[model samples]
Target: MATLEGPDVQASDGESDDGEDIPPLGENDNIDAIVESIWVQMAFDIMYVSPNPKDHRKPAYVLLDQEARTSTTPATFQRSDLTGIFRSVLYRELTSSQWETVVFDSFFPLPNSAALKRQGFRAASYYKKWHHLMARLRRRDIVVVRNELRRQFRTLLWVPHPDTDRMWRTRSSMRGFTRLPASSTGPCPLIAINRQALQGTRITLNPPIDDVEQGEMDEEDF
Candidate 1:
């Protein structure tokens, strides 16, 4: 997901061809699951590059969940296994082009001593991550991609961090960890670990692309 930008819209705008029997998926609640998130990242960014060769020109976006990167979606897919959980969600239909990903470890090996104790993750924290997301939705990279060899919009997937407990959860924002303030168009649609939304065949996530730049960033949470 390069500097994703241009026409970020509600999921309804993008069509879906997902299967009927894919297993359910959720957050990193099962932190000790045999499969590591890093491995899932590797699988999608590499192993699951492309298959049907759909419209490479189709714009796409990914929420890049901090905790549930691989819980349900099968990051790896074969030429014909379009029903894979991860593939189904991201590529709901044959979508997206090249892929690149970051690697992580169960031990959270980064020197950020807190990394080791990383069980699940808080919503938004880093300034760059927050800024980058809003910028993309607000058409940040539209001009550059237009000048280059791509379309004006990028197809994006709304992946949310799960709320392992309802006691601390509600229909939340779709902007990942960032609790972005209301834009000129008001707040983003309530998405996130809402089982009602996540388990549905389609979800509506609207990116109004408004005054996110002027909003405050709560960089300390989770």
Candidate 2:
């Protein structure tokens, strides 16, 4: 009679700390099972791109570990699928005009390797990958549209405030005028103009003579 040992138990026996032991092969092991496990792990892993506030207009790619509920910034090549998924979500959220603005204003004229190096941008590899993804989006080469409902998506940058008043006040320095009481809508009211305090006195207009030149001619004749 042969005694049976578990795969882990046999592998761990006499293994050194520096190296890991290869588990003994089991009857149930197969290539398909291994590949399926890999695919399942990939499906659970979440990733996205968002604007980095500290880095001005530059975007940051982030990996969200679902099990741990923690996140880390990952390289572009490390997780292209996540980037592709987020790009699709963004495309769906934006209108055609908005998409044009985002593409043209945000990511156009992609920085070259030399420029990235000069600027000391750490995520140069990620940006290169992002550029390729953007190119694909422009070409409409997307094949798989992932379910955005499954993930928590965020924008690459802080979305600007839609309220014009808030945007104006926050963006510009009010130089001369004093900001009055806040209104329910529109900009803060400026200090009211004091009509009573105006300096000039009102003058009455005299009736105009039809022939003022006639008085001048009589004076010359006399």
Candidate 3:
């Protein structure tokens, strides 16, 4: 957490005056759970590859799953609740003018089918519009930060794709689903959530990172 010494001192420690943790956007369980679980099957969902530290090499992106989604409508995104620094970093990534390819995870197809449709209602139409915006950004080869699959769900699904199951053929390599036969698309920045897997295994979204402390003491009975 950043320091808060100026006028915004009240916003520090993730708390409100009445004493409640300022919940992250879309952290709700019932609504977000459904969104993430379904997005794991969406056709266009992707996971960026982080670079190797030992080699000291720039990160290279890979296409984990190519046939994840069939949505021709594209994707749209809206950024909210993030700090100015993070938002600026994201914009810089998008405007970096680098050649890039958006890869897919196994979860892409399912979410596209579930969330996108021309239902003729204002809410549904707006939803589709947002997704379209995201797709357009990807077309520009921008590094996106918004949750393409489960934006509403505070949690992420790191599990397997619905269509196929996979197991590790090597300790560091994965088999099953689909692999890049002979595609060398070059290097680009990797985008992923801060949280890691549960017990360093299984696909799972990590909880929020806490840096500040918040507490309150009432003097009612005392």
Clashing pairs in 2: 50-156, 51-156, 51-157
Q: Which candidate order results from sorting by TM-score in descending order?
A: 2, 3, 1
lDDT of 2 by residue, 1-222 (tens): 111222311221322221323343344444233323322332222122222235444322122234322233222212213322211111012333443343222322232212222221223333333333222221211111111211111212212111211111121113433221111122221111111221232211121232235546767999
Tens-digit per-residue lDDT, 1-222, candidate 1: 243312341122121121112222223223122123332342343222212223455222223343433333432222122121221121122123211111111111222223312222322122112122222222333233222212211112232222322101222233333333222122222212222223334432333232232233422321
Prediction 3 global C-alpha lDDT = 0.24
Query: What TM-score, computed on C-alpha atoms, does each candidate reach?
Result: 0.18, 0.19, 0.19
Q: Which residue runs does candidate 3 get wrong by more than 4 Å?
A: 1-38, 41-44, 47-60, 63-152, 157-186, 196-222
Instruction: Put down candidate 3 lDDT per residue, 1-222, tens digits, no spaces.
Output: 112122222212333222334432222223333333334323133221112224455321221223322331122112222221110111112111110111132222222333232222112223333343233232212122233332332233121111223210111222322221112122222222212211233221111122111111223334
Tell me the whole-model lDDT of each prediction, alpha carbons only: 0.25, 0.25, 0.24
lDDT minimum window of 10 residues, candidate 3? 87-96
